[model samples]
Each structure stands twice: as structure tokens, then as C-alpha cells.
Target chain A: MTTAGINIHTGKAMPLNQANVDTDQIIPKQFLTAVTKSGYGKHLFHDWRYLDQHEQVPNPDFVFNKTEHQGASVLLTRENFGCGSSREHAPWSLDDYGFKVVIGTSFADIFYGNCINNQLLPVQLTSSQMDQLFALVESDASAQITVNLQDQTVKVKDLNFGFEIAEQHKTNLLKGLDAIGQTLELDDKITAFENNLPQWQKA
Target chain B: MATTLYDKIWQAHIIDAKKTSETGEEGLIYIDRHLIHEVTTPQAFAGLDEKGRKVRCPERTFATMDHSISTRSLALDACGPTNKLQLQTLADNCKKHGIELFPVGHQKQGIVHVMGPELGLIQPGMTVVCGDSHTATHGAFGALAFGIGTSQVEHVFATQTLKQSKAKSMQVQVNGSLPIGITAKDIILAIIGKIGHAGATGYVIEYSGEAISALSMEERMTVCNMSIEAGAKAGLIAPDQTTFDYLEGREYAPKGDNWTQAVAYWNSLKSDKDATFDTVIQLNAADITPQVTWGTNPGQVIGVNQPVPSPNDFSDPIDKDSANKALKYMDLAPGQKLSELSVNNVFIGSCTNGRIEDMRAAAAIAKHGKVAPGVTAIVVPGSVSVKAQAEAEQLDKIFIEAGFEWRLPGCSMCLGMNDDILTQGDRCASTSNRNFEGRQGRGSRTHLVSPAMAAAAALAGHFADVRDYQ
Candidate 1:
């Protein structure tokens, strides 16, 4: 995944240490009322993070509220992360909450795409790799993980896990490319495709 | 190379296929239809405004206000200021963009999935997308339809194309005739139960075999609507006589010569006889029973007659953990009979089970008895047209007389975005798709079932097997 202008960054890791976390849990539906996207940061994991609806009582057991995991920008979770709902608010909330990278064994397709668009890199590693990372983070909250987009590798103490992502997705993160602008460059091709469409397609 | 039904549609719309990703072929796929709703589009519309971009193809795009609007009353001001502003934003955006909109008060307006097919806006071989997960509902028409995030919505708005690496194809073959009283909802719940929630991840499922073909177009939609519940972006059935007949005389359907030509092309849209799939799953239709989701995810389901399973029931530790958590949240113990569970509310609606056919099935059961005194039962039709059709057939009367509330059409009680919601800690037998923790309301629990099961549960004041009613 090495390319020009690719940047590598490291951050303290926080372990959610759970699987099948759906978007509803990421940012609940009640908070989806805003027309703007910025205010969802405080409400991320609204239900699990708080014992009350008003955010008055922070659940002490939740990782995000745990003192050790505070200020950690990396989120480590297990399989099927972001499994339900097509809400981009899930990624927006994660990005706003300062998570630079989400490493999981697998991700739901729509959630993966949403994360890429927002530059919240979703790195998929093997189940064993995830387990090791989770253990590292759990044992030492101050553990830092390096994400090298150019090398497509996540590095921690004595472990360098190479992960796979789509080439275009990688490029977009590195370049912060405008997808709409790039697609418009193919306007001629789009027009040609539309013109050749069958009569039933036009209606 | 032999082509699957999914491959045939994907190949037709692929603008470029030279790039390959870890999953499969990566390319730009053209979208023919883009559906928009209130909950996910305000940001997308704002992004478009920030870029000063016009919608690439307004005709192909349709807008609606369903998710957050008040379904109890259609009046614009009935929803609080927060919801009103969001609804206004969509209405303004649609007017400015010149996109056809089915606003909240429109008779044709309902859930996007329910209204899309009724107007013939979705057709075979077309690629459709929306910002909501149930967008997969359109795939029942043999279209390559999937949900997208808001950024993808803006991307589609500006380019009318999606950048995606093709998902591997899986064929779920449900052969043999369905047993009496088994419906499409039962079959899909059974499928999810067999394949865990993540079983279909990274694949586009093509449901085939005699059982799928026998389903009506509406019933096929019921099966495809929950594709996301199993982690698949889309699931499709091959278009056949039933599909064509359903679309034949609809408003947006092709007329005369175009109609004749459309059928000819659609007839050729099936998979090749020797087609290959990356994964194949076979299940006997006879084995499926009326199902209910006892756990949070759709995959954690069982037949109505069964007992709640313990975490030990799942061999995998991760699954075992999820089960323990879900059981704790659901407040049930292992070996507890599912039928003995009492429900305080019955919600029969959503994109999954809110169509006319769903209404008829539920009403058929409602006619036999009154809703239990303390149980609150409500039937929310999928669309305005579905509401009218139900009323015309006097199905609404049966529900009302049986003490079930006949409500307006919206995704009310399903996602609990609208005014209709369950009280905290209320247990509901619902016909909605997801039963995620707090989906209905904070501390509210949902038991997913078919419409008939929901109605029967209302009558019996507990989780009752629909087969017993029959």
C-alpha cells in the first residue's frame, strides 16, 4: 500500500474486546436527529457509556469511561464490528471521539466504506492478530500501536501485522481524494453508459 | 465462464473491472436508482451544498420523509421542532434538486422499500442504493441493491456511481415445498439461524431453489429485506413471471413495446445453468418452522415451540459470550419455554413485515380473538397505499375491533425514531427486522416474529405459535 504522501501515525490503544458491535451501539438512533455531524462525539456509545439518558451517569465499566483507556486514539475490537445499520454516524462518532484507526478481524461492508471516506482507517487483521493486540492493550493501557498505511502494517511490541485493504481505499486515505470529483472526470463514460441503456431503464 | 445471477447484473453495470482487491474484482458500478430518506440525507444534502454540486441524475433519484417523521398524525407541525426542521430540510432539498419526492403526507409515501416497488420505480437488472440498510429490500426484484453510508449518499448524489470491490457470491438454496403455515418470514429467520450473523458477510447472496421461486414478489421482498441482518449487503431472487406480472401495470413500468422488450431481457437475466458460486448452502423448506429471535441479533433465533438456549448452546466462545450478554439483556434463563413469555406490546410493521400481504396475514389471526386486555397491539402499514388497500379490504376494521390500534404508515415502533415507541422495559412481540438492545426504546426488549405470530401473541397475551391459531 506504499504510495507518495502516505503518512504513518501511532496512538495509545483501547480495547473494547467485544464482537458484533452494531452501529446502533456506536451511535444510537436518538442522537441521529442532528442535521450536522459534529455533535455526536460526546454521545458515542450513548447507551453503554452512560447509565442514564442524560449522560449524567457514566458507566464505570465501559472502556471509553475507564481512566486507563482515556485519550487512546486506537480502538481494538473483535469480529463483525459495525454489523448493523447503514448509519455513517457510527464512523463520524468514532472519528470525532478521536479514534484514528479501528483494527478488527472483520468489518461490515457499509461500515468499512464509511470509515474509509472519513479517513478513519479500518484495518482487518487475522483473529489471532486481533487477540494479541487486545491482550497487549488490556495488559498495558499505555501501549502504542503504529499504523503505516504505506506498508499496510500495524506494529506493536514484537508484532508487525500486515493487513489488506482495497487499493483505492488506501489511496483515498493517503491523498484525501474527492470521490465525487474523481467520478465526475468519467462523466463522458457515464453519459455513454446512460445512452446505451435499454428503454425500460430510462423510465 | 459460467455466470451467477448476481454476476450477470454486476457485469452489466460495471464501468471498469480491471482493478482487483483482496475480496474480488474492484471497480466502479453505475447506480440506476438512488433513494433518499430524512434520517441520513441532511448531511449528504449539506455536503452537496458545500461543494456547490447539483444532483447528477435527478430523475433516477427519489426522496421521502419516513424515518423520523410523526406517523401518529401526518400534519407537518405535529412532530416537534427538531423533527420538523429535519423534515423541512429534505423537502427543501428535494424541491431545489428537482427530485421526485414522496413527502410524509403523500398517500404513496411510506417506507422507501414498500413505496419503491409499488410505483414500479425499482426494476429487474437495475442497481439501487439508499443510506438505510433495508435498501436491500429492492433486491427482491432481481436488482443489485444495497445500503450505503451518508458519504456514499453524497457520492451517489454527485456521481451516480459507487466504487466497490465485488463481494463473493453465495447461493442459499431452499428446495422442496414449504410446509403448510410456513411463510417467507419463517424461511429467512430459519436461514439466519442456520448461518450465524456473520456467515454471509463478504458475500452477495442469491436465494434460489423451488421455495424462493414459489414466493410472491412481496413475500420475496420479505426474505431479502433482512439480508443485512446476516451481514450481507444484498440478497436477490431471479426475476421470473411473478416479477414481470407484479410490475406489468404499475405507474413507472414500461408500456407497450418497451414492456414486451423489457420482459425479453429480464427473462435472460437468470444465472447460467452451469454457473458457479463461491459458497453453496442447502436447506429443506419443510424443516423451517415459525421462528422467533430470542437474542439480540437476528441469527440468535429459534422456533416458537423451543426453549430459550443457554450460552453453552453455542460451541464458539465468541458466540457463547454474545449469547450470555444477550440473554442477560433479554432477561431469560435457559430452558424457559418461548411460548410462556408474556409480551406487553405487539408491533406489527416495518419494512420487513408492513406490506399488504403482511397485513392480511396478521388480520386473519386478529379476526379470531380480541387483543388481551393489558397488551397494546398496533398495526402500522408499510405505505399509504398499503394502508388504503387494507382499509378497502376491511382488514383495518378487524384489527380495530380486536382492540389493536390501527396506526398511520411510517417506520414507527420499528426503529422507534418516530413518536410511536414502547415504554421503557416493555416487552413487545414485533414484526420488525432487528431486535437489537434498546432498538425500540431504552430498556425495551423486542422479540422478532412474523405478522401472524405478532397478532396471535397479542390475542394470547404471550408468545403463541401461529400454527396453533391455524
Candidate 2:
């Protein structure tokens, strides 16, 4: 089935300056109890975003808890934005939490893949670009950034920055095709190869 | 032309390769084996059902119930309702797909990484993918093994192929002889400590040099298992005679003429003598000491006798901030000796260090006497077979006699998906991987150590150096 496709996104950016913000901190293990991928938005960044286990009080110190950055849809962070575990729940949490674009200097390979599969845009910018974005977002909490997937460019006011993504990944995202659906398009080729395998090697 | 070991394996597995539209790099490599576990596969199965697709080459896929299975008892019925539902879903999925499953309490049931090698399902020059990140552990046998996301898992299940891009290759060459009390765990921990947590990002590491060559298969597995902890895509050691020897008599291995041919092929899987790597890191074995993580991440570690680091010690602001947070979460002060930190629990198991050798090492320490009063020590084997072998050798008896609980095999307390978890605010010396905040249990502080060190900590009721116990 075709997944959600994104061509352009314009939204307020949330600046989380921390580097190497791992998947565990994004969505702690305790919150992974749900078998399905829904309802994770409420528990995103469970530990840092909340002051207690009951999650009733927001941690005022955390950036997301600030009222100025409320309803932000873009996440601006430092390098290795998604490190540690390969839990797809991480991206699920981010997606459910209403983040449509993640702009960072770098991302862990698996997390990047998970984000792509879930139709969340993971944009890789240079450290200087990231610093500029973080500064702009921090200075004006309501500043809106526009990310154009087709043009591979991110823009805010007069500042414009170009980025790079794998061509196939760009196509997949534009077409809203999940990897499994794309692979299924090659069913004939896959079956032919499997059928031709030597008897000893056949499963 | 010289080719790196990674090139050899990657080239061999190209069912279809095409240049990516963006980078013009080759992508779409086929997977030979797909390993599944209870925690990561349920959603994939649902996706498959939604798409009305059948599992292609089910024989090439294997499933196990490890992550969420209860390890407190041998009986599968002992698992609680939620865990039982997960286990049941996994079993049902495997049955529907015709995939072989090593369910809970099965003789072959164990941690996916541990059971793959023990059953000889992992072979040299193979491409193995798993839903779990520790799938890199299979690279010990010269396979191209790495973790994949749930979407990728569904892709592999439906087509036995993965869309991929090339990864940079790095060689970590550790030379010289290891010092006493040092093990593979210490070597990997030291490597992480030296390189920081994200040093090997976007690359696959080929561990080489004399120190790596000298390790046994189990030790090699332990080293490769933690490659992901350092942010590497995978870690591999070219199969040598030692690898062939280890696989020769195991179940699922090729036999007779097939074995002969496999040996000849495995011999050719090594990197060429003139092969060049994108990056090379050289480490001296003599420089490594027994290691223990004192912070939230695996890289926040020091030698056994080293003092906890001050945040000021870090030159990078981010690293310093991480250290400060780690210290607060771990409830420790700077400059405190790691050996002086008291532990409320000692856990000796997980895919990282839960092998027969690790068990023997812990048993050697437990044989001395009972564990120190008030220390809750438990030994959960990596697999049912490992438990059986340990019991056969009376290692379980030694642990039981020393006041350590002998439990069934699974990923117990490693990720705390099961009942075996550290209580909140409890300090634990664990032989498992990942000391991240709440990794073992919510609000629990974890100090990652070697099996011997964990056992020693159990006996001393603190982080005692294994060398002192010896």
C-alpha cells in the first residue's frame, strides 16, 4: 500500500540542542508496552518531557515543555539525533507527536531508515547550517521553516539551504511507497531467482 | 585487485544491484537469512497480512521468542498475559509463514544471536538480517549481519531482499597480547571508550590484527555483538580455520562434500592482503584493562580502578553535558573509584556475554563461596542449550550453591522486557550490553561489566575487580 507522501512542509521548528539524543530518551522502554504503533505521541520523550512517572506534570526545563514552542512540527537537533536502539517506536513516537521534519547534522543509520519508512523527513544539513537553524528557531519560537523534498532545499525567511538525499529514498518518499510495497513490485524477479536456486540452497 | 572482506561478502550477495537515483551508488542487496524475535516481528506480520503477501523463502527465516519471554521460570506458562500474548502472536506468525521457530522452553530456544551461531545457521559469506540490532553478533562467523527496521523486516520477509546503500569500511586492528583479567568484553568497552559512542557511525568495522585473531569463536561473538553499541553498522572477522572448526560439528552446518566446498569458499572470504579501508584504528591489547561503564551510555566507561570522570574532563560541550546527566541518573559523584560503588543486584547474562565461557568464568568466582549477604545475583543463560550445557558441567550447581539464582535462558534483565528486572533506584553490575538510563528497569542504575567482574561484584557486594578475586 502507498504510504503518506511529503513534497513540502512549512511549520514552526522545535530546537532540541542536545547531541546524540538516543532512541531510549526519545521513547523510553516502559512506554514501549503498546503492541501497536499508536498512542506513543502522548509519551514521546517520556523522561525528559515529564517530571514524574504519572506524566501529569511537564518538566518546565525541557525545551518541548516551553509554551513558546508549542505545536511545533519541525525538530531541529544536533548530530546523531537518533542513536542507540533500533526501535521503530522511536520514529513512531516522533511521528505521533506531530513532527513532520527532522533537521540535524547527522542521524543514526537505522533511525534514518525508520523515519523514511514512516514518511517522516530526516534532513541532513551541515553543522554550520544546523547551528544557524537552531539559532533562528531559538531566537523566534514562532519562526516557520519550509522544507521542500522535491527541491531538496530548506528555507527560512531570506536564508536558503540545499541538502542531499538518496535518489531512491527521495522517490520513495515522494511516491509514498513503503519499502515493502516497492519490493513487492519486483515480485516476479524475486520469485524467479528463488525458484532457480539450487536444490541444496533452497529453503 | 585486493578487496576488503566486506566487499567480498557484499558482492557475493547481489541478487540485483542498481545505482541509486541520488548518489548513483549500488543498492538493493538480497538477504540470505532473516532472523525474527517476538518484540519486533508482530507489527511486520500485521503489515504482511494487510498486504496479503506470503513470506518468501520461509526456510531461510527463523523466529525466536527472546526479548519479551519471562526468564524467571522454565515453564512458558509462567509468563504473564501480555508477554504470553506476544509469544503466542510470534508463534502464530511463524506457523502461518512456515518459518521455523524456537519458542520458549524449546531445546533450541535462546537469544537470537546466541542460537544462530550455536545451531550453525550463521555461515561465512552469508548476509544475515535480524529485527534486533545485536544481529551483528552473527558477523563473528564472517557473515554480513546487521539489524534492520520493522519495515525492512517486512521487506525481507516478503521478498528476501533489502534495499540498501554501500557503507564505509573501517578496520580496527588490535595488536599485542591481552593483560590478565582482560576479556573480549573489556576490549570492546575500551574500543568504545576510546572512540566515543558515535565514532563508527555509517561504517562497517572489520576487526583484525593479532588480538582479534587469537580469540575463540565465543569471544569473537562477544566482541562483534557490541559493535552496534559503538554505532557501527556491523563488525566482522574473516572466517579462519577456527571458524570452520567451530561450525564443523554443529547442527545445520553443511556436511561431507558440502563441508569441504564450504571450507574452500570460506578461506577465500578474507580480505585481500593489499585491501585498503576507508578508515583504520589501531589499538594495543596491552593498553586495555578490565572495563566498567559508569554512566548512561556504554562509551561512558573507564578501567576497573579508574575514578569516575568529572564533566570538566570532557573537551566537547555535548559530551560534558552527557556526563553530567549520566552522573545524576546514575547517582554517582566524580572521582569515586568504580570498585567502591556498591551494587544491589548482579545480572550475568544477555547476548553480549551469555555464553558457555562466560558462564564458566562466573562459576569459577562463585565456587569460592556464597554471594555476599543482601546481594541479589542471578545467572540467566543466553539459550536453553547453554543452560543445559552449564548444568551438565555442574556450573549451575556452583552458582546456586553460592546464592546466585540459576534461571532459564533469555534476554533477561538485559532490556527488562521480562519479569527479571532491577528494582527502581537499584544499582546493578550487569554483564549485558547497553547501560542506557532505564535499560534494565525504570530508574535503575546499570554498570556494564564482564561476567567475571559481575560475579566478583556479587561476592563482594560491590564493584570488586575480578583480578582481586582471582
Candidate 3:
């Protein structure tokens, strides 16, 4: 479990609406060397959100920089959001930037796992459903959406959509259980399995 | 049950099958091998220390420094203070945990994916993983390998097990023999070009067919390395005689009776004759041409003879918009021939195309000519072993004599993590994967191609057909 874990959240929805938004764009390689995961939110979408190399001036055109969508806790985008790199820092930046849920038509596998690990919900909806959410956010920048982990539902006004998440991920997110601690309980099982392994299977 | 090779391997790794667990469906799958690099493992080691947990299986774990290390030289101080800290942290962490580390200057040290296979640390019918998207490179041996985030890395360090949801199976069948000059890099780029980058988002692709079967082991590794570019966590080819041959004399491969047992097990790892896949994509090798990326993403590509694509050329609106954004970032005009444009830089290396075979292919082209004036070219081999082998064969002389810089091994100019960066507005023909905006460096425009193609471009100072040079 984490002190920063979330179960239910409702806030303004920001529409990126682009497909295949990769990790390099999410957080550029230059900022990956920090000793810890925090302090990355400022650099989230660093290349796209900044007008200059120093990142001092925010690009006014980016959705996240727009005054109306400034504290959005939900990100609504098109297909294959977070498509490259196994960088958990991508989700770390998203969580640090106050985003509780990433709504997409589809998501890259490793990126999805990272989001679950960090308690940043990755909510997958159909293409049309994603279109609807994009339309909702585009029409009213202040539009708020609610994500309920227990129900596995993402609701924007009256339009409600169901999403699928691994049962294990859901339980961990809801209970704030740390994955490593939980696995440590299986030490005996691992030992037993190792004892019966073939020669080539062991180092 | 009609089980695929993927199913067989995935099922074999299951330590526990949990049907009702809140954590995962496949339950706990044992990790047979773990490869680590400096960039992602520092946090994982710290996480272990935070929890006061030792590495559950240090013997199965391996560490290396690549991502942030200096490729300019072997000395630790050559890396800037920041990179030095990251490298030192990994070495210190590995020592504390009793894990083996191939540090800088280690004769076998190189890129994680490159060193792993060349050393025979990876094998067929195993579950391999690393905190890198290119861990799929190991899947070329028919291992069920995939990338994991640092949290998963920490979890693996603590338990040597992962709770995973099995991926759907996909078979990409490449039919007929590859035409001359069409390398595995071109085939994979062509595959991603046909199926958009997100085409296989939720599946683990098992490549099969005449074209796939015909590829060398290193070529197969090149293809599987870019599985992440296709948005799949892993892609694999079955282990055949070719795989066995590649592993026969490697440092870590089994010996004598153990080898016999291993080969027998690997043979059974293939899919049954009538097995079915969740999805199938078909491509004929004859139709594929030398591919060149016209836009930022790997999927936004065209054949060598084709013109740079306009946004209007794309049928999907998302693709159209993405094309517009890419063209603008790359500062290229649509409808213009890519071959007519000049490149200021050419880089031939990365996990995708940094092996001995890749070196030979590029060296063949470089030996015949000099690097074009005003163009800067560099050859960064994938690992120390690969570099030594290339040097032994005098391929380094060919590159250096052709005016291309002969750099040491690391992921130089691939992600631009080190000082090997592209200056602003530089256009480069790079053998590395990913052509994302600023991927090479700020304001850098990258054209992805095979090593032969990159070498040809270096000779011509422009995007030239490798077939023409050969």
C-alpha cells in the first residue's frame, strides 16, 4: 500500500485526444536521473507542454496548461496512450501532477502495469466511448468525471461506461496493499517450487 | 486444447494458478532470469532497502551499467558526475545483494539485451524480464520475456515471481523468402508500418512463416526488440536448430547431457500443429521494400522509392493529424522524395541493430567507399563482446577508415542518454529504434533504417537505397 494511493476520484477531465502518446513525450529522458520519483510532475509532457528548452514558459496551447483544465485529475485520450518505454516514471509524473485516472481507448501493456502499480487508474473504454469523453471535455473544459474503482465505472454527467481491470489490481488499489509485501507471504511456495526444478532451470 | 507455443511456455512458468485472486489471473509465474541496467534498478534496489528485504534469488539476477554510462571511453570518470552516481549506485547495490554486475570496462559488458544473449544467459522456454522495454529482445530465444516497471522490478527482486495477466496470442506470418537487401530491420519496420504502432497492444506476437524461419538468431533478436514499438510487451520466435547453434559455445549455455535435455525441452516448446492464434497478420516478403520512417512514429513509414507522405494521405484522422505533427517536427515537406534529402549525421547501433551481424552488414557497405563530406557517422557496437569480435574481423578499421567514428559500446545516439547527442536541427540516418520527436536530441530529425541502409546513407550523405550500394 502507498500513502498516495487512491480509490475514488472526481475532477476536471483534460482531453489530449491523441493516439500513441509515448513515454518520451510524457517525460523526456533528460529528467529521468532524479534519485526518487517525485519532482517529475513539473516535467510531465515536458517537450509538448513547454515553449522553450528551459521549461520556464508553458505552452498556452497545450490542454493541461489551459486555465480551465488546470487541476484536472483525469486524462482522457485516444488509442494506445502511453505506448513506449517501461518507465514507471511516466505514471509517477502523472500521479504527481494530480491525475488519478487515465482514460483511453487502449493502453500499452507495460504502461498499464505501471499505472496499476502506482494506484493511478488506467481506465480503458471503447473507441466511441473515448470519443464521447473527448467530446465532453472539448465542449466544456471544466467538465468533471468520476472514477469509482469498486464499481469499475467512469461517469461523465449522465453518460456512464463500464471498464475492465484485473481483479487483483482492483483489490490492491482499493485496499492500498503493497505488491512486494503480499508476495513475500508466498516464500514457502517459491522454495518448494525451486526444490523440484530441473538442472537447467536453476543458475 | 489448441495451445500455442506462447501458451505452453506461459503455462510452464506458473507457480500457482489463482482463479479468484485480487492480484492476477495467471497467479504467480516464476521468473527464470532477470537482467538489470543502471537506469531503472537504482530505485528498485532502494525499494528493497526500504523494506529491509534482500534479493530473493541473487543467482538468477544479473546487473549491468549501460543507459547512463559513457560510451566515449571505458573510464568511470569519463561519465559526468551524474552518470557516475547512477553507475556507482548500481555497482554498490549489486555488491550489497551479492549479484553479478558487468560494469564498465568489463570485457563482456554492453547493452543489457546485447550482452545477455551473446553470453548465453538467456535460453528457450524460460521467463525472462528486465526493467526495459527491449527485454523482448531475449524473446528471440523463445523465452516468455517482457518489460516491467521499477515497481515490478522491486517486486521481482523481493519474490522472483510476478502476478501477471496472460497476454492474448498473435501470429505474424511472413511468407516467402526475403528479397535481396531486405534485412530483418526492414521486415519489422515494414510490419509496424502495415499494422499501426498500436496494432498489437494487448497481445504477445509469435512470429512464424518462411521469412521468419529464414532469419539468423541476431536478425530474430532485431525483430523481437521492436515488439515494444508495435505496442506489444513481448514478441518471440520458436527455438530451432538456428537457436541451438547460436547457444552451442556460449559461456552460460548448458554442457553435455544438460545440453541434450535443454534442446529436447526447447523442441517441445513449439506450438502444436493445429494450434490457433487469437489474431493473425500476414505479410509477404516479396512485397516488402526498404522502409524509411517519414514521420515520428515507427508506423508512419513509406517504402524507399515512395515520397514523404502528406497528412491527407492517411485514411484515419488520428494518423492524419499525427502525420501533420510529425512532418512539422521533422521539418520535412510532404510529397518530396526522402532519398533527395541530405543527412548531416548517421548512427549505426542500438539493441535493434548493434550485433556482430549488423556490423558485418554495415561494414560491407562502408569498406567500398568513404563517408560523404560534411556528414558525421559513428558506429557504437551493442556490447564489448560484439566490439571485440568486430575488431577481430577488422570491421572497426572499415568504419574508421570510411570516416565514421569508432565509439565504444553503449546505447549512444539511440536515446541520447549520454553525451552522444544530435545537435539542434540535425538530420540523421540512425539504425536505432524510435524516431519520436527529440528522441535523438532536441530538434533532431531521425530516419530509422537498417545498418546497411545507414552505412549507405553515410557514404552518400543522403537516404540511399542499400540495394544500390550492395
State the DockQ of every prediction: 0.77, 0.58, 0.75
lDDT of 2 at B322: 88
Report the lDDT tens digits of candidate 3 across residue range B116-222. 99999999998999999999998899998899999999999999999888777899999999999999999999999988899888889999999999999999999
Q: Tell me which residue pairs clash in candidate 1.
A: none
DockQ of 3: 0.75
TM-score of decoy 3: 0.97
Which pairs clash in the backbone of model 2? Answer: A167-B22
Residue lDDT tens for model 3, A1-203: 15455678999988897888999889988777665778788899988898898989998988778888888889888888888889888999998988888998888889888888888888989988988888878888887798988899998887899999877878878877888888888889889888888977777
Best by DockQ: 1
lDDT of 1 by residue, B211-282 (tens): 999999989999999998999979999999999999999998888999999899899998899999899999
- The lDDT per prediction is 0.90, 0.88, 0.89
Fraction of native Cα-Cα interface contacts (under 8 Å, chains A and B) also present in model 1: 0.73
How do all models score by TM-score? 0.98, 0.96, 0.97
lDDT of 3: 0.89
> Residue by residue across B116-193, what tens digits does model 2's lDDT show?
999999999889999888898989999999998888888888889998888889999999988888899999999989
Candidates in descending TM-score order: 1, 3, 2
Label model 2 with its docking quality class.
Answer: medium
Q: Residue B312, candidate 2: how far off, in angstroms?
A: 2.0
